[model samples]
Target chain A: MFNAIVSADTLRATLDSVSVLVDECKIHLTDEGIEIRAVDPANVGMVDLRLDATAFESYETDGGIIGVNLSRLEEFAGMADAGQLIQLELDEETRKLHVQIDGLEGTLALIDPDSIRQEPDLPDLDLPARVVLEGKDIDRAVTAADMVSDHIALGVETDEEAFYVDAEGDTDDVHFELGRDDLIDLVAGDAHSLFSLDYLKDMNKAIPKDAEIEMELGEEFPVKMHFDIAEGDGTVTYMLAPRIQSD
Target chain B: MFNAIVSADTLRATLDSVSVLVDECKIHLTDEGIEIRAVDPANVGMVDLRLDATAFESYETDGGIIGVNLSRLEEFAGMADAGQLIQLELDEETRKLHVQIDGLEGTLALIDPDSIRQEPDLPDLDLPARVVLEGKDIDRAVTAADMVSDHIALGVETDEEAFYVDAEGDTDDVHFELGRDDLIDLVAGDAHSLFSLDYLKDMNKAIPKDAEIEMELGEEFPVKMHFDIAEGDGTVTYMLAPRIQSD
Candidate 1:
């Protein structure tokens, strides 16, 4: 048994953060909090989300798993404004999730938990470089790179003492760089990786401009971004496998 | 010779007003101002637009006709933000309209005046009812009607002493009414007519919320909406043929 009250905004941010990488996920609701870990079907990206009890207006659970179609949730949640209060309750007998707003309630059929893919095991990596900055900065760089190329390279150019996002098109190239003082903080190391701009562009939608983002990277290795949502009540982590650059 | 500098907002609003109904138009640049009148290919709607010389930052034009594709102009004008200075220059020798903004100058080819459709003759209408209100009020009513039906009936409810926009769907009916106190003014008469929501919805995009809209209607007659644009330097008139109500 699990039921809770939360803002439409918090729910939207939570689902949107994971729906970008996976279509469905099994939400684990426990007495302490809630957690969801899922990976993209192509094995290219993974999203891990966790929210403590404090995140919900009122929360109670007897420890259970609820499988849901995130794509559908995105649409249902879209109907409510950001500030509206949303109530969620499980209809165990009918295998449905009841979503209630001010004067309306929509019953959504829950997917069988067995149908969803199993969660991926978290990888252990000694990423050499770490950078902290506003999510909007990376969002801006991603938008600029998309105008020029399909892929962008994130790297710390040691010699230049600056981090850069670079993209090259057939006839044009774009590059945005930030020095030490420009970033919130930097644990500089010899690290660089290229990634698909398409993925980054979709990921940016879930990240608000004012939110802080911490990034970890290594030479020819995957990139990881960590951020908080629900007013710091929940944490969302994104890990994307790097695309190899062919010379 | 026709050359003028106008605010991007005025140009966008002017082109958007007529382009909603007609694709190609012949702009007449007379010493008084610029004007265009066109009807949609289906002959269901007519848009008449006029802007005085005062609307332009700088104006100079010896009476001349310039054929243009309003759809293409919409795209070019969209490149500049509202309030930006947009310079329009015509090169008679090249048959080109040069639009200059900031560091960019886009040259759009002009359609041959002979190839465009002939100007439409203004129809004489004796609509019996007149309603004056904010353009936004009609915009809101149209949007609500779109949710329930494709055609909406507009008329005065003499018994109720109110102007009503009514639409009936398969299982739902929506009606927005404005009493005399709620409207700017209303000249009530024995009038009722149905109009396609599709045409009204498209026309609403060009009508600013702050502009005053005057509407005329009669039993089984065409509906005419009039409003000013370009800071009162221009007036855009829209006449939509009525859709027969199939009771």
Candidate 2:
């Protein structure tokens, strides 16, 4: 019998806002670690998440399990009445988590635990460049790209003294420039990279636009984004592998 | 040559929130009168919309003109820098509306005017059962239904009774009940009706949960939802043709 208590709104808000990309549907569960991985549809994008176990009120498991269909759970959490404490009960046989709120009356079925795949080996990369930015800036950059194309080219040049994203399509072309004042911090070399627009959008959904995001970029490498979801709550980190461009 | 200025965030928020169900891309512009017709995918939903000439800083057009892809403009508005004034320029030949925000420094290609469909005619009906509900509560109901099924059965018995939405699926059966306290106000009806989930979700997206929503329901009839959008700065009303269940 495993029981856990968490602010349904908090968890729901995070998942609904994020989880837009990768469909792997794995959330690492440990005494001290928790992670979630889900893929967005081809046009939709991908997300890589790493959260500390401390964020949970009470996290206890004899071992650990991965749950499928996080998007379903996110939807359920979104349905929860506000200010209501969400109670999660894991049923062994049915292999479903029964979700209930304190005052409201209803039971929500979580996707079966066994249905989600476990990726034991997600490559660890040494990202060379790191930058801290406001959530609003990232959201703006994503939106700017929407006007141009589905794929974005990102570059960091110390000589240019700015971080930029460029997208060009038949209908429109867009360029986003972030200066030193707008960026909290930037660490870069003369390196550049590009990735699928679908993944960036999914990853941005996990956090609010106002929250601060820490980003790591490398030449032709997957980008890492760390979302400080709520001050003093916990962190959600996403690392998305870059899509190679064919010239 | 036609040009107008408006707050990007406000216009974007208003349009994005209300156009959730409207498919007729052509928004009629005639002597400050605006009209459009679209069907809600769900029978149990409604969106009430009205933007009088007085709301516009400038009202210049006397003939009806089509406006396509207002939704795409709204998406741009979402990312528009706060307090930025949005400049709109219309070109008759290209049927494109050029959108520019000062600080953002970009141009957006709006939907062609000719491609937009004309507004549909929605006759006025006598909706006896009407009530005001907190936007948040309605948002919750939509979310709850998202978890259980794609269809929702909305019934209003009386103020003394609770507002109910019931959904049954193979995996789970769920019911959401909101009492008078949970409701801002409630009105009763002789019978209830069911609607598609997709429509309800779309309608929900058009209005904020904190905003007041007036719902009218009848036996096997389309649901009428009136939205006091932008704090009465404008109005958006939706009448969804009902889908009669086989059973």
Q: Against the true structure, what is each candidate's TM-score?
A: 0.54, 0.53
State which docking tier applies to candidate 1: incorrect
Clashing pairs in 1: none
lDDT (CA) per prediction: 0.86, 0.65
Docking band of candidate 2:
acceptable
Q: DockQ of candidates 1 onward, in order?
A: 0.04, 0.30
lDDT (tens digit, per residue) of candidate 2 on A1-247: 4566667766775566445654436555666546665544432234555445565566566446646565666656665556656666667677666666633344545555566543434457787777888888888888889778998877787776678888877878998988777789988655477788877776666657887788878888877777765354666666666778767
Evaluated with TM-score, which candidate comes out highest? 1
After superposing candidate 2 on the true structure, give the runs of residues whose Cα lies further than 4 Å from its correct spot.
A22-24, A39-46, A57-60, A110-114, A117-120, A170-172, B1-167, B175-247
For model 2, state the Cα shift of residue B2 in Å: 46
Worst 10 residues of 1 chain B by lDDT: B167-176
lDDT of 2 by residue, B1-247 (tens): 4556667655765576547765435555655545455444432344445565555555456555555565577766666677777766666677667766765544555565566443456668776566678777677777776667787787766645666777666676556676777767777655467888788787777667678877777777777777765446677777776667656
Give per-residue lDDT, candidate 2, residue B69: 64
